[model samples]
Target: EPEVTQTPSHQVTQMGQEVILRCVPISNHLYFYWYRQILGQKVEFLVSFYNNEISEKSEIFDDQFSVERPDGSNFTLKIRSTKLEDSAMYFCASSEETLDQPQHFGDGTRLSIL
Candidate 1:
């Protein structure tokens, strides 16, 4: 079955550098999201996108972060400047148009900043 997929499963980056985490959601899904798990903390929602526009975003998604659907099949999350506190497991998810549908998540991209 088709599922969400992420690239560069493990990313190690330097502080103040830029990082872009990539994701490919299920082909037919209509809604997309980006979330992060900071070490032992709960998963936090970053943003949601649909029809190439941001549907909603959390306060944690500050000016340093951005999301895009650069093409038909790929969705991406970019951190303009990496910080040590930014280290986390970033997950990409998607769901069908219906709100009741469960969102499918990728294995996640583990980002470690130093």
Candidate 2:
């Protein structure tokens, strides 16, 4: 079966540098989302995108963050300035629909802020 894939499973970054996490969602799915989990916190939704525009976003998605579907198969999340609080597991998910579809998540990109 096809699955979501993420790159650089683990990354260690400086406190103020930029980082881009990459993901490739399931080919036929239309809804994509990004969520982050702090070491001992709940998964927090960052943003959801469909039809090439943002569908919904949470307060966590601030000015320093951005997302893009640079190509037909690749989705990316960019953080302009990393902070210590940014250390967390970033998961990329996709589903056939939002209302009742269960999302499939990648193993995740574990970001470490220094």
Candidate 3:
């Protein structure tokens, strides 16, 4: 049973600093995604990637956000600038086959922007 792993269990940064969140799914997966949850808000879809390209993205994924699969097993999300409102738990997920398949999620990285 493989799983998705996220780095920097927690991050504390300035409001304007750049942040990179990394995830590694220990399986031959093709679909990857990034989601975020504010402390008291719902889980919001950020972006999805396949074939080394963005397959779907929510409005939340603006010019400030970007996703990349820099390697075969690793996917990353970079925030050009962190805002105080951006503080939340970021989750990385991957599906072995397609978007219709179930996905495995990481423990989530709690980002606190001050």
Model 1 agreement with the true structure over 1-114: per-residue lDDT tens digits: 998999989999999999999999999999999999999999999999999999999999999999999999999999999999999999999999747889899999999999
- What is the per-residue lDDT of model 3 for residues 25-103, given as tens digits with 9 covering 90 to 100? 7578888999999999999999989899999999999999999888777899999889998999999999977736898
lDDT of each: 0.96, 0.96, 0.92
Error of 2 at 82 (Å): 0.5
**For residues 1-114, what per-residue lDDT tens digits would candidate 2 score against the true structure?**
999999989999999999999999999999999999999999999999998888999999999999999899988899999999999999999999999899999999999999
Candidate 2's C-alpha runs over 4 A off are: none
- List pairs with backbone clashes in candidate 3: none
TM-score of each: 0.97, 0.97, 0.95
Query: Which ranges of candidate 3 are over 4 A from the true structure?
Result: none
Whichever of 2 and 3 has more lDDT, that candidate is: 2
Q: How close is candidate 2 to the true structure, as a TM-score?
A: 0.97
